[model samples]
Every structure is written in C-alpha cells, then in structure tokens.
Target: MRISTITNWAYGVTVGLTLLSGGAFILSARSADHERQAVVESQALDELSERLTMAAEQTSEDARLFVMRGEDRHLQAFRGDENGERDREQALKSFKAAALLQQEMALIQEIEQDGEALDAIEERAVTAYTNGDQEGARQTLFGAEHERVQSDLLTSVRQLTDLIATRTNDALTDAKQWSDFWGAVAKSLLGLTAAVFLGVLYFVLRRRVAMPLMRMTGIVNRLARQDYAVEVLTDNRRDEIGEMNDAIQIFRDNGLERERLDAERRADQRTKDLILQMMHRLQACQRQEELAEVVSLFAPQIFPDFAGHLYVMNDSRTALSSIGSWREPRRAGPVLTSAECWALRRGRPHVSDAAAGDIPCQHLEHADEMGICVPLSAQGDTVGLLYFEGASDSQAIASARLYFELIAENIGLGVANLQLRDRLMGLAIRDGLTGLLNRRSLDDALNRIARDEQGDVIAMMVDIDHFKRFNDEFGHDAGDEVMRRVSAILSETVGEAGTVYRFGGEEFAILLEGGAEGSALDLAEKLRTLIAATPVTYHGRLLGAVTISLGAASTTADMPSADVLLRADAALLSAKAKGRNRAVADWVERSSTDRRRA
Candidate 1:
C-alpha cells in the first residue's frame, strides 16, 4: 500500500477508537455523576435527621417544663411563650423539612404521623397547664401521649436515616462496580490499540522493508567477501530491489570473469617460468651431445610421450647428421640418400604424420618410427632439425609442433652464440692479415716449449728482405697479399711440427718441437725457397716475388733463454744485410759462421 493511504487508514482507526473511548468516558462520567448525587442526597438526609433530633429534644424539654410548673408562663412558652415556643417551632420546622427531604413514601408517612402525635401531646399538655393543675400537668406532660410522640419521632428519624445509609451504601457499591467495569474496558481498548500499533509496525517492517533490506545487506556482504555464488531474491514490483538484484548478478558474473583471468595469468606465468628454467639448462650445454640431452629433457617437460632425435645440418645443407637420438644405436646404419639431402636443402620445417609420406631422415628404415621435423634456424639459415615421435593413443602433434618451433628457436640462438664466441676467440689469437698466430700466441707457445725437458726445441726469426721497398713499389694492399702468401707457405711447411707467429710487420717467428739446429736450418731453407719461387697476386695484378732471410737457434743449449731467440733475430738481420733469400743457422756452431760473417 502507499504510505499515504496506510497513514490515512491508521488515522481513521485511531480517530474511531478515540471517539469510542470518549463515549465510554462520558458514560463512566455519568455513572460517576449519579454516584455524586446519591452521596449529596444521603448527606442532606443525615443533616435533616440530626436537626430534627435536636429540635425534638428541645420541644420535649419545653413541654416538660410547662407541665411541671403548672404555670400560664410555661404554657405560653410551649405555644410561643418566649424561650420554649422557639424550641417548639424549630421542631415543627424540622419535621416539615424532614417530610420534604424524604424520598421514600413510607418514611414520609412515618414523619407525618409522628408530627400529628406530637401536636396532640402538645395540646393536652397546654390544657392541663391552663387549668392550673400542677399534678395534672405533670402527669399529662410525662404521660403516654408525650412518650408515644417521642417514640414515633425516634422511629421516623431512624427509618429515614436507615434508608439514607442503605441507599448511599448501595450507590457507592454500584459506582465502584461501574468504575471497575469502565477501567477494565478502557485498559482493554488501550492494550488493543497498542497491540495494533505494534502489529502494524512489525508487518510493515518485515514484509515491505526489513526483510528486503536484510537480504540486500547479506548480498552486499557476500559480494564484498568475494563470494560470487549467492542468489538474489527480489520482488516483481519494479523497485530498487529489482535493480539491486540485477546489480548483484552482474557482480557475480564479473567475479567469474576475474577468476578466469586470474587462472590464465597464473598459467602463463608457469609457462614462462618453465621456459626460463629450461633456458638455464640449455646454457650449461658445451657440446652438441649436451645440447641434445637438454632438448630431449625439455620435450617431456613440454608434452607427454616425448621422444625425438636432434639432427644438425651440414654447412652446405646437403647432409643431416644425427647429433643425438633418444634411443640406443641400431645394428646397422641406414644409408641416407640424395632425396633426404634435397629435403634438407629446402631448409624449412617439415612435418610427416601420414603413414607413407616422405620425411627427411638418415635412419628411417623402421615403420614404427613416425615423426615430424622442425628446423633450427638462426638468422634465416637452417642449422638443425628436431624430430619428434607420435604417441600411440593420440598425437599431441600440433602442440608438439609448436613446442618444437620454440625449442628450435632457442637452439638456434644458443648455437649461434657458441659459434660467435669461437670466432671471436679465433680472431683474438689469429693474425688478421696473415691468418697465422699473432704475437700473443707466439709468447704462449715459446713459454710452453721452454718449460719442456725434451730432446730439442728450435726458434727461428724470419725477415722479409726489403719489405718497405716491396710496399712502396706495389702499394700496401700488395704488401699485405705478399705477407699472407708467405704466412701460408710457412704454415704449410711447418705443418703440425711447429707453431708459426706473425711477430710484427715484415717479421714472423716459429717454435719448432723436436728440432735441433739441423732441423731448424732445413725448415728455414724450405720457407726461403718457397717464398722465392711463389709470387702473390692481388686484384688480378701480379705482385713481385718476395724472399725471407732466416735465423735459427736451439733450446738444447744449457739454460737457453728467450734472449737466445733474440740472438737468432740478430742473426737474421745479419743475413738480410749480407743478402736476401737465404737461411743463416744460429746453432752452437753458428759462432764460427758468425765469425765468418763478421
């Protein structure tokens, strides 16, 4: 109901109840007024009885005095004789007033009869006094007539007083009953009114307000606590409760969405963490076998039933070499054909799940071995392949393929890094112009050999004859070409027996193992002859032929120092000063050769 309508109804009820209670109060008041009138009448009747009794006593005394004295004076007093007549008149007036005040006919009749009896007694007593018979007057005054009058007077007054007392007591009883009845009725009406008010308040709050408010509060608390499972209760009446219910449903829906997002976020984090840990293991790999082991371990970590072989591509991509396979070696090696080479040369990731389709494999003689291949590429160049087998139940082939692509990417990066490190190290030690060991390598080699307690170690110093003239005549590029050619010749001649170093510009050094002065001098002569015979060509231009003068010494001498190598270099200078394109041996016997040169 509308509040205004409800309020109007309640007001009407209250006004009706008020009018009813007021009528009840008015009735009770009238009952009370009747009781008050009864009280006043009883009190007035008592006053009349008291006055009559006093007046009767006075009249009796006056009549007794007049009769006992037997005097006209006393008779006058009885009639209107000064003092006694006043008493008689007062008694008569009281008798008349008592007659008027009496409501009962029986009491009024008694009063009239008592008044006539008194009048007769008064006449008799007055006649006796007028005759001057004192004795007769006394007898008449105290006789039966006067006694009958007083007895009638007492009886009439007692009857009137008894009537007033009885009626007044009855009136008080009726008023008390009426008061208790009305009090009970008013109390009952008040209690009913109060009960109605409370009942209306309780009904209004519970159905229209309190219950819905409590439900809304409960929903709010549940939503605040992230409990999205609660259901909302609302009315069909299109009010705030309907909107609130809709809002709660939306909140639960949003909570479900957030929960889904949170789960996905955690899953992605786990994947990234696994990849990072896998990367850590990959970094520890030193050789191709170790890399294969890492890849194989990562396979099961990414997918179920993972078995695969890692194959590396050759420089020309015309060959596939299985670096590591996840099983034992077979009894025989399956021969790889040219078709497999062609597939590898195509240089793309290829998958084969079909029973009879061609897949590039050097060892695919068995039908049980089904697989797919993904290439490990670095900067668009295919470096290797990761081959995975299919499961017997179902192929996680698609997911496995994705994993292989990711794994291949990491593999490519790792291999590229390793190759780059090797190249950098090679560049650090190798001579840039000559492709031989630099001075640093020479120092390392000399130190190692000097520490050896072997049969012999020889050091040679070589100087190209007139290298400055060669550079000036043919330009620096041609000079560099000459140096490279000479370095190549020296390296080819020394083979694995010695280490060659480009010590500086126009100068080179060598550490020859297991060599005495004879081996050193023979090696130097070979280098000199080779350079004299060969000429370097640069940019299709013929550069002049070059020759190197050589000096040789041995570690066989006691406590030989690197300074002895310096003596060999000094000897090379002497040889170059004498002539070019010749070997000058600086052996123990070189002192005699040195004296001759001097």
Candidate 2:
C-alpha cells in the first residue's frame, strides 16, 4: 500500500485506541464515584437505626423517672421524651425512603410500628400519673405490655443496625471489585494501544520506509559519480521508495547513454587527428611514390579493418593504375580503364555491397565483395581513385565513409600538385623548339655522366653543313623546320643509347654512357649518312640533301667532362676543315697511324 495510507491507518488506529482507553478510564471513574456513594448511604442507614434505638430507650427511662419521683422536673422530662417520638417517626420515614432492598424497608416498617406502640403506652401512663395515679403510671411504664413493645422496638433497631452494617460491608466489597475490574480493563487497553503504536513505528517507519531509503541513498551516490553499472532495486514495491528507484533507473540509463556518446566523441576526435596527420604527410610528399607510401602507412591506422588501394590516372587520361595498396585481402589487377570504374565514370563516390543492386566495378576481383570507390578529384578534374574494401558490416562502412572521402580529397590535391610540379619542371628543362634537353640541362647531364666511373663515356658534336645558306635560300621559317627535322633524326638514331641536347642555334650534342671510341665513330658515321640521305619538308616544300659534319670523343681514365666536350668540338672543326658532310673521331686517327707504323 501507499505510505500515506499506512500512516493514516496507524494514526487512525492510535486514535481509536486512545479513545477506548479514555472510555475505560471514564467508566472506572464512574465506578469509583458509585463506591463512594455506597459508603455514604451505608453510614446514613446505620446512623438512622442507632437514633431509633436511642429514642425508644430515652422514652422508657423518662417515663419511669416521672412515675417514681413525681416531681415537676421528672414530669417535664417524661413529656419531652414523649414529644420527641415524632422526630423518631420522621427518621424511620427517611430510612424507609432511602432503602435499596425490600427486606430493609420491611425492617424500617417494623421499627416504626414498635416505636409508635411504645409511645402510646407511655402517653397513657403519663396522663394517669398527672391525675394523681402514680401506680397506674408506674404500671404503664413498667408493665408487661409496655415492656414487650419497648423490647420489640429495641430488637427491631438492633436487627436494622446489623442488617445495615452487613449490607454496607457487602456494598463496599462489590464497589471495590467493580473498581478493580474496570481499572484493570483501562490498564490493559492502554497497554494494548502502546504495543500497537510501537509495532507501527518499527514496521512502517523503520523497516519499510527507512531501510529502503538507506539503500536508495547508496544507489543515488553511485549514480552521481556516473556509475551506470549499479543495480536499481525496489521497483516492484508500491510505495514512495519504489518511485524513487524508478527515477534512479532512468538516471542510470541516461548516464549510460551519455557514456556511449562520450566514447564516440573521443573516437571521432582520434580519427580526425589521424586524418590531419595523414594530410600533413601528404603535403610533404615530394613524389608520387612518396605520396603513395604515406597513404599506405596511414590508411590502416585510420580504418584498421578496411583494405584499400590508391590509383592514379595515367598521363593520357585514358586509364587508372594502382600506385599503392594496403591490407588488400582480395587484390585486383594493377590497371583498369577509366570506363571500368563507376566512380570515375560518374565523377563521384560509389558504394557496393551484397545488397546493392548496382553493377560492380570491373576492377574489383570479387563481384560480391563490399567496397566503396571515392574518386579523387581536384579543381573539377578526377586525377585518381581511392578504393576501399573489406568493410565488416554496414555500420562500419557507414562510419568510414566520411573519413574515406576526407582522405581522398587530401590525396587528390596532393597528387595534382605533384603532377603540376613535374610538368613545370619538364617545361623548365626542355627546349621549346626541338623538344630536346636545353643547354642548362645538358650541362647538368654532362656532370652526372662524368661523375660515374663505371665505364667509358662518349660525347659527340654535330653541325649542319651550310645551314645559314638554307635559311638565306628558303626562309628563316624553313631553316627552323630544317633544324627541327635534324633534331628529330638525332633523337631517333640515338634512341635508348644516349641523350641529345640542342647546344645552340644549329649545333647539337650527344652524351653516351658506357660507350667506346670505336662505337662512338660508328654512331657518328651513321648519323652523318642518315642526315645526308634524309630530306626536310616544310609547308609542302621539300628541301633535298641536308648533310652535317660530326665529331666524336671518348673519355679516358683521366679526361674531365669539360675536356671531353672541348675535344669533340675540336674534332668537328677538323671535320669541317677536311670537307663538309663527313664524320671524324679525335682518338681514332692517332690509333690508326700507330697501328700502320707498327
């Protein structure tokens, strides 16, 4: 039951017990009053009986004295006693009225009759004595009839006194018994009320209310400290404590929810931190390989359960090829056409799983594998792809999507920047007219090749014969076309064997690593023959028979890179001095002469 109901019941019961106790006390008080009244009535009856006896005796004595002495005083005394009989009669009437029992009333009646008879005899005797018949008075006062009446009155008085005494004693005993019984009842009622009050206090206040409150206090304390693990009891009760327990349970549930949100917040912050770190490393990457390495290293830490690959579009913008991959449980091929990937075709991120009804990407090895493809784009151009796989569940994939997109965005920008830098570097080092390494790059290449001591290095210098005459005959434009065609021929003839550089307006240089003097002479002669046979066409005009003079030099153990280019230039001048459209080697002529002389 409710606590208020229990308290009200206890209060009501206590009030009822108090009222009963009060009633018992009132009854006991009434019984005590009746006992006192009984004592007073008993004393009154005894006094009346004694007064009746004295009146009878006094009349007898007074009548006898008047008869014997015959004096006036004696006569007056006799008359006084005779006249007081009326007072005695009144006392008998009072006693009869006050009597409680029939037997007591009957005794009062007998006493009244006896007193009246005695008074009649005395009165007759007193009249005779007054008329000078003393004998008659004496006989009346002391006669057998008078004496019998007086004796009867005295006996009746004695019986009445004894009966009053016995009745008063019985009344006193009964009154005492009644008072005692009610007093015991009052005491018992009071005792019973006290026991009930104590029981209510112990059971309701201490056991039911206080004990549960104490337990709830502990539970609330734990909940205050954010401990949601504590158990909440007392929910089954129908009391105030049960209501409090329910409230505590709600608090615990909220605390648990708050804890879950806090954990997610921390995890999200950690993931963001990892993403920021990965972005910093990406920005620091100097090459595509370095960027790939950074992505490979950070991707696993960012999404540990996911396996992914980084793909960069080829230079032709026709396809994408994998540059790096990490934690790939199911590997795909290294290359894929741009048309094969939905993300590339759609220019957005695409997701596929078992339940996804869309067609899978052609690059994926397993058609049923769950994955997401985030196209890496920057400035509206899709530069690469960031593909992820091995999402264990839908929740995991959903959680990873944001981070994956973040990674793709940063990596795309990074790769774009790298590609731009490479293009700028190429533009800076390449010759615009002939697409060969310019003079500045040629100097750098010569230094690098000469620094390597592995094998002989060859340098060749070629000059177009009468190149100024062609420009003077046709035009500067045609002359420019002639130079372009010659550069192309040099590049094609020296393919994979050496590097070509446009040294000046009409002069070209070649550096071949790991080549001997004899091979250099052979290569120089081939270049001379090809240039003499090939014709240049410009704007539908064919310029015929363009030839060149070539000089070749090979590195000795002690030859410096600067001397190698100087000797080749000297040999080219000698070739021009002998005749145009010819090839010469700086060391081959001396070697031929020594062999002939030996």
Candidate 3:
C-alpha cells in the first residue's frame, strides 16, 4: 500500500482507540462518583431514621415526666421534645419525599405510623395531667397498653434503622463492584491501545518505513558522490521509498551515459590534437621526405590497429614509390604503378579487401588483409598515395576513413608544393630557348670555381659563324633553328665532360673542369667541325652547313673567372680575325703541351 494510505489509516485507528479509551475512563470516573453518591445517600437515610426514633422516644419520656410530677415545665418539655409539629414529623415527611426503595419506604411508613400512635397516647396522658386527673394520666403513661404502643414504636424504629443499615451496606457493596468492573474495563482498553501503538511502531515504522529509508539513505549518499556503480535495488512496493529507488536508478543510468559521452569527447579531442600536430609538421616540411616522415610518425598514434605506407608519385606521374613506411605493413609493396591501385586511377579513396568483397589493389601481394588507399591529391591532381593494410576488421578502417583521407590530403598538398617549388626553381635557372643552363647559372658556376683555390678550369667560348646570314636569307625562324641545332651539338659533344651555358643570343660558353689530356684547342676544334659537318634542316629547307668560331682559355692554378672569360673572348676575336671556321687558344700563356689549331 501507499505510505500515505497506511499512515492515514494508522492515525485514524490510533485516534479511535484513544477516543474509546478516553470514553471508557470517563465512564469509569462517573461510575466511581455514582458509587460514592450511593454510599452518601444510604448514610443520609440511615441518619434520618436514627433521628426520628430518638425524637419519638424523647416525646414519650417527657409525657411520663409530666404525668408523674404534674409539673408544667415537663409539660412544656413534652412539646419541645416533638409531641406536636416536631423535627420527628419533618424527618418522616422528608423520608417520604426521598427516592427510596419500596421496601425502605415501607419501613419508613411503619416508623411514621408507630410514632403517630405513640404521639397520640402521649398527648392524651399530657392533656389529662394538665386537667388535674393525675392518677388517670399516670396510669395511662405507665400502663401496659401505653408500654406496648411505645415498645412497638421503638421496635419499628430499630427495625427501620436495621433496614436502613442493611440497604446502605448492600448499596455500597453493589456500587463498589460496579465501579470496579468499569475501572477494569477502562484499564483493559488502555492496555489494548498501548498494544496497538507498540504494534504500529514495530511493524509499520521499523519494517515498512525505517528499514527501507535506511537503505535508501546509503544509496542516496553514493549517488551524491557520483558513484553510479552502486547498485540500487528495485522495490516493487507501491510506496514513496520505491519511487525513490526508481529515481535513483534513473539518475545512475543518466550518469553512466554522461560518462560515456565525456570519454568519447576526450578521445575525439585527442584525435584532433594528433591531426593538428601532423598538419603543422607537414606545413613546415621542405621536402617530400620530410612530409613522409611526419606522416609516418603520427598516423600510427591516430590509428594504432593499422599499418601503412607513404608513397610519392614519380616525377612522370606514371608510378608511385614508397618514400617512408611505419608499423610493418604486410601486404602492399614498396612501389605501386598508377594502374596498380584503383585510388590512383580514380583519384579518390578506395578500400581494398577481398574478404569484404571489395576489389583489392594489384600491389597487394595477399588480399586477405583489409586495406585503405587514400589518394594524396591536391587541386584535383593525384600526387601520391597513403596505403594502410593489415587491418583485420574492415569496418574499423572504414569508420575512420575520413581521417585517413584528410591526412592524405595534407600530405599530397605538401608533395605537390615541393614538386611545384622544384619546377619553379628549374624555370628560374634554365634557358628558355636552348634549354641549357642560363647566364645566371654559368656565373654561379664560375663563382664556385673562383672560390676554390688551386683549381684548373678551361673556358671555351663558341659562336655560330655568320649566324645572322640565315635570318637575313631564310628568315629568323631558320636562324633560330640553326642556333638550336648548334646548341644541341655543343651539349651532346661536351656531355658530362664540361658545363654548357647559353651565354647570350647565338652564343654558347663551356667550362671544362676535369683534366683533359688533349689541349683545349682540340675540344674546341672538335665542336667547330661537328657544327660544320652536321646538316641543318628546318621546315623542309636545309640551312647549309652551320659553322662556328671558337675561343678557348685554360687556368692552371687559382681560377680568375673574369680574366679567363676575357682571354677566351679575345681569342675568339682573334680566331674571327684569322678567318672564320677555326679554333683559337690564349697565346700569352701555354700549358707544356702541343697547342695545335684544328
């Protein structure tokens, strides 16, 4: 039952019991009062009967005295002793008016008649004595008839006294017994009320209210301390405590849910922090190797269950090769061609797991393991790949596919940025027309030679001989074509032996650093002969035989970059002054070798 209902019922029953007990006590008190009143009334009736007997006897005594002594004082005393209108008659009248029992009233009536008969005899004797008939009044006062009348009256008075005493005693005993019965009933009722109170205390308070409350107190305290692990017992009772137990259970459930969410939030924040750190390092990397190293270091921390590789697409964009790897991946190879992986072909993320019924990458040797390939793309162009394999659970990898793709994106951008920077650097230092190192790069090479003491460098300056004749004859396009062919010949003959630069328009410069056994004129003569020997063809027209004059200079010791170039230029002017199709050397100084003009 509900606690409210139980408590209400207890209250009502207790009140009713208490009221009944109080009523019983009230009845008991009234019974005691009635008993005392009965005792008092019985005593008053007994005292009235005694007084009437005394008054009648005294009237007879006073009449005898008046008849025997013939004294007027006796006669007066007879009247005073209640012979006429006395307290004796008044007692009779009061007894007749009282609420007496029928037998007691009969006794009182007998006393009244005996007193009246005695009063009449006594009055006749007194009246005779007062009229001078002494002998007759004396005889009447002492006569047997008078004695019989007086004796009978005294007997009736004594009987009335005995009757009053007997009736009073009976009344007192009956009143006491009745009072005692009611008092015992009151005491028993009070005892029953006490038992009811004690039963309620033991059963209702201790079992129903107190014990459950005690258990709930501990549960509540644990809940207050945020200990959701504490068990709250379910109570099926339809009481306040039962409702409280349910509420506590609910609070514990909510607390557990909150804890779970907080844990996930913390884990998510950790993932974000790792990603942030990886991205920052990526942004700072100057090379693809550095970017790969950054990815290798942080990717495992983000997803520990998987192992992966960082691949960089080769410059031709035809294939991707692993630059770095981490966590000992078992399936994918170190190199993957563009066609070997679907992610590279499609430029998107692809999961490769034959167990999951997905197409596997060709580079994966064993397709039993799950793998995810996120194409590292920037500006819609795939630069590289991030391949993770060895995950047993495909769902695990797929769930975090977004994070993997994000990592791939940043690394791809880094790789693309490095490639772009290298391209830009190449454009800055390379010649646009002949595709040879420009003047700026040649100057830098000479500066390095100047910095290196005890270094020998040979400077050869070659120019196309009458290169403007073709531009004037067949147009500048043919001239441009001739220059391009001559530049290619110079580069091809020099190969790895020296440095070639397009010094200016229709002019070429070469630096030969490694020791050449033949004098510098031989290499210069070979270059001039080759240019003259090769046929030049452009737009279906042969631009005759293209020839070149050469000026060559060699440094024996410390390289003076400016002085050597000036000597080579002066020698070239000398060769032009000598006649066009020939090679010349600086004549002021000579290495102890044969300087033959070719």
C-alpha lDDT score of every prediction, in listed order: 0.69, 0.85, 0.82
Worst 10 residues of 3 by lDDT: 589-598
- Model 3 alpha-carbon drift over 4 Å, by segment: 1-36, 52-78, 81-83, 86-88, 113-277, 300-308, 313-322, 325-373, 379-383, 387-401, 419-598
Q: Which residue pairs in model 2 clash with each other? A: none
Higher-TM-score candidate among 1 and 3?
Answer: 3
Candidate 3 C-alpha error for residue 56, in Å: 5.5
TM-score for each model: 0.44, 0.65, 0.55
Give the range of the ten consecutive residues with the poorest summed lDDT in model 2: 78-87
lDDT of 3: 0.82
lDDT comparing candidate 2 with the true structure: 0.85
lDDT by residue (1-598, candidate 1, tens digit) is 5544665677677677766677677777777777787677667666766766676666667678767655555555566634344443454455455434346556656666776577667667667667666677677768787787788877777776777678677877788678667766766767766766776577655665677778878988998998877776645645455566677777878997898788767755665677777788888776656777776666565654656666676556566677666544331132232345333556666654345566535445454555566667788776666666646443455545555677678987776666666568779999889888899888877676657655577788988888897689878888887888888899999998888899999899988777666667777887888889986788888777788898877764563755657877877877877776777766644678678999
Please identify model 1 stretches exceeding 4 Å from their true place.
1-282, 285-348, 352-371, 378-382, 387-403, 447-456, 588-598
Please give the RMSD to the true structure for each candidate, in Å.
Answer: 14.8, 7.7, 9.7
How far off is residue 198 in model 3, in Å? 12
Error of 1 at 385 (Å): 3.8
Across 413-531, the per-residue lDDT of candidate 2 in tens digits comes to: 99999999887887888888888898889888877766765567888999999999889988999998999999999999999999999999899999988876777788888999988
Best by TM-score: 2
